[model samples]
Target: MPVTSAALLLHHGRGADAHVLIAHMGGPFWARKDERAWSIPKGVVEPGEDVEAAARREFAEELGVPAPDLPVRDLGPFRYTSGKVVHVLAVEVPAALVGSPDDPASPDLTTRPGTSTAQVEWPPRSGRRIDVPEVDRAVWFALPRARPLLVLGQQPVLDALVAATTP
Candidate 1:
């Protein structure tokens, strides 16, 4: 059976050029990569857990806060090149929640990078225990701009957003 994941496509506006939230992939393998590396906050669906609940849980685990109490619209699912299906939700969060670079409370900018730890072995087989962040940081970008920044397989997820919300 193919694996399925849940993702959050947070936006702040409607139609084209909508600002979307993204997180940089963490851990060593992705550390030096940039283009086509970032991704939506998402995780695999666990047995018996509601997909939406799993999505919310993943977002909190990665971002260090509960997802804002906003209505979430299902954008449906897509299969990526890796052959995994991902169910995504489109959420429109207020700018205040993800404030500007000049704002003191901005989790994406004005403040320090958000950190979530994962235990891994350094040097692969060396068995040295090391803790690395689950995500290096997060930022918001317009859909077009986010395209080049998003993981290649997830581009369709953004396209779905544009098509669904455009008038």
Candidate 2:
């Protein structure tokens, strides 16, 4: 069975985007084009890899940052248009603990070209390269603002995450 795991990436924003939480991603197979790309840190669990363990590993390898100690609430799984089953999980992280993978210590950072640091070759024919952990930046975005930025398949997880954090 083909299965994947990912993170509900988040960051802290004090100014206008404060209450807003954001996720990180590169983009889909076709729509990718700088900033238009979005994603949560995710990857396929290797055989015998535990679910939570896969989530944590994907987060670190994809984001190039250590996984937070936040509690992960299993948000269940969802199917993608590709017919692949993706397991989702949510975690609430303090805004302060969040930072770009390139500058893992820089809180006011954005844009990390090779920060995603993971790669996957794509197109059964072209064999072009695609990066795994496909995000270069991650930031918190307020409600409604995040709608257009999230990957098509992962938005529901974000909604569930918002509900989980609210009230």
Candidate 3:
């Protein structure tokens, strides 16, 4: 199996109720702007790693914020454009916890009990590295408002999250 990891679907207090923090994906492999450009914080999981645990780790790595204590629903699995099957899990973070990953003025993103944060370089060429702080700019959304901002396949994940959370 081509292994992949999980990500947190976050909504900031300032934006729409369903606003998710979508990364600009700074690496050379990703586009600098435009649609089909954003993605929830995600990565691959190593062997023996717990799926949820890996999700928490990847969330912290990509966004700089600690994983929220919100409930998680297994969104099951989906394949990427690369044919890698990813297991999706959704977790909610309150508005207070969502913000700019590059904001040096903000408090440090705290870690969940057993989880830790990691960093990766973007642009793939600058030889300069940047930390994955959960997300670049997290914003709230109202579903319809989120359409153009989210990565192509990611919209479905948000919809699934809303459906799972809805009464």
Give the best candidate by lDDT.
1
Candidate 1 TM-score versus the reference: 0.85
lDDT of 2 by residue, 48-149 (tens): 888778877876655556667667777778677877766877665566554434334322223443344445666646778765545545555564666666
lDDT of 3 at 165: 66
Against the reference, the lDDT scores of all candidates come to 0.78, 0.57, 0.58
**Rank by lDDT, descending?**
1, 3, 2
Q: TM-score winner among the candidates?
A: 1
Estimated TM-score per prediction? Answer: 0.85, 0.67, 0.66
Candidate 3 is scored at a TM of: 0.66
Instruction: Give the per-residue lDDT digits (tens) of candidate 3, residues 55-135.
Output: 777776655556676777787777767667667786555545544453211222233232233366665666877644333
lDDT head-to-head 1 vs 3, winner:
1
lDDT of 1: 0.78
Candidate 2 local distance difference test against the native: 0.57
Reference-based lDDT, residue 17, model 1: 63
Q: Candidate 1 at 50: error in angstroms?
A: 1.2
Model 2: C-alpha RMSD to truth? 5.1
